[model samples]
Target: MRVFAVAEIKFGELDPVSIELLNLANSIKGDGTAEAVVIGNGISKYAEELAKYADRVWKIEDSSLENYNPELYVDVLSQLFSKEKPDIVLVANSSRGSEFAPALATKLNAPVITDIVGLDTSNGIKATRYIFQGKLLVDILVKDGDTSVFTVRQGVFKEGSEVGGEVVDAGIKPSVTPKREFSQIIEPEVGEVDISQADIIVSVGRGIEDASNIELAEELADALGGVVAGSRPVIDSGWLPKDRQVGISGKTVKPKLYLALGISGAFQHIMGMKDSELIIAVNKDPEAPIFGVAQYGIVGDIFEIVPALVDKLREIKG
Candidate 1:
């Protein structure tokens, strides 16, 4: 059972998701050797870093790869896979990894699984992913084929993974330089809250209504000493930054305490946060799906309910 784990990094060093993959690859196995594929311009040094954690590190350096151009990066990896022919591939369920994993799966004629929370290697590398907003855990197994690739969901694996493993350099062939020039990449500015890492998160949704109403949610979050997050409408309507959106289209989280304020849990919104430990929802609609998973449910409008709750929280804190 040979595996090629794909890890990409920016700024410096492998990201948290890559470290998670390394820890996973280091322990379990399906059949063959475990190898890592890293791509960057001067990624050779980082290749040495990964070697301390992985069995082997394959390197691809192209000037065009200084920044991510999906087309160019994909072309490089595709060429490498054709030559290397590893059996299983693992990647993070990140933006690029999600976009690229299916494309690679299509190219290799193998099944692709996304947002995997657990792996059942007991039966030939089967994985478990949430279906129906984590209401059920589905076990997935890819039939024997050219290569099976997995893009893991962030925060599923345990933390405190150290970077230390063996080193093998894959001196991969360079591709034609990409003609397109990347001028400026604009990244959205977001405040600090690794919501995925937070044990408690209090998120406001469209039900909060006005921009001023958001302060109530913030007060609640502060009283709980938890980070504040929100749904798409809450963010898109300029009630909050886009970074705070918690939904299928936004960042996923796995907090120990998740408080839903005025948000009707649409399946898409629920998908991103369903991995939370304990969910508490405050919504006027008792029929809202948010109530389905909410350990504690309050059926009321945010306008009346939040202030009372805030007072209670402050009293307790005081």
Candidate 2:
């Protein structure tokens, strides 16, 4: 059995999340071998690096692909899968990977395992995932042919040694570019430290209320000397930027001190952030699910509670 892992290449280097997936894929090694696909304008040359973690490195190049076009990439990747006939296809659960994996699975009529933590092929390709905000681990068997599409969560695996990254050519052909109706690819302008790896995160949720109320969370974050983040609704409502949103839909952050203000934890939201070192939830509702994973729980209104906490924290720090 052979596995196809998608290579996430950026600025000529492999994305950290892709490396993490390769490590996990390598761990459950048996008769199965792991390879990766490097897709970009000039990614064929990076076969050496991809070969460090995969048995074979399939590279595709086209100047048109320099900028990501979802339609065009799906076409190219689908074509590669047609001929490769690997036992499994593994993709990183990043933005582009998430979009392509499901669509490709639909076309192949193959089973898909999304945001999965572990896998077992012994029982004909069974996989497991975290359910109820990592509160439970549910196991499910893959339903379909031997081919399965696995989109792995980004932080599931740790960085490890570069082992089977040997570069064998995939020998795949490129198809004619489809007329792209996409307006244009616009990379969002960002100038902040990546919150996903921050040592401490002070995030606000719906309980904080309107966008104007954000200052309350900001002040507390400042008092703690930590970074600020928000839930999906907060970022989608433009109270904060997309990069600032935490949980599965947004960036999965694992901070040392994760302070959630007024955010009732949702399953999709908490699965990403439940790995923090210390979780402190400040929600008035005592039964809020955020308390389930939080190391410290404060059932009180943020408006009245934060000022005192900030002042006390400052005094203690001094």
Once superposed on the true structure, which residue ranges of model 1 sit more than 4 Å away at CA? 11-13, 23-34, 42-55, 61-64, 75-84, 98-141, 152-163, 190-194, 222-225, 232-238, 284-288, 297-318
Candidate 2 local lDDT, 1-318, one digit each (tens): 778778786545667777676677676656667777777776765667767877667777666667666666677778887887867888887778888888888877788878887778776777888776656879988775857888887665654567755665555545656666546555446656567757788899998889999887888888888888999889888998887878866777767799999899998778778888899999999999999999999999999998898889889999
For candidate 2, the TM-score is: 0.72
Top lDDT hit: 2
lDDT of 1 by residue, 190-218 (tens): 56555666788899888888999888888
Poorest 10 consecutive residues of model 2 by lDDT?
A: 165-174
lDDT of the candidates, in the order given: 0.77, 0.78
Question: What C-alpha root-mean-square deviation, in Å, does candidate 2 show against the real structure?
Answer: 4.5
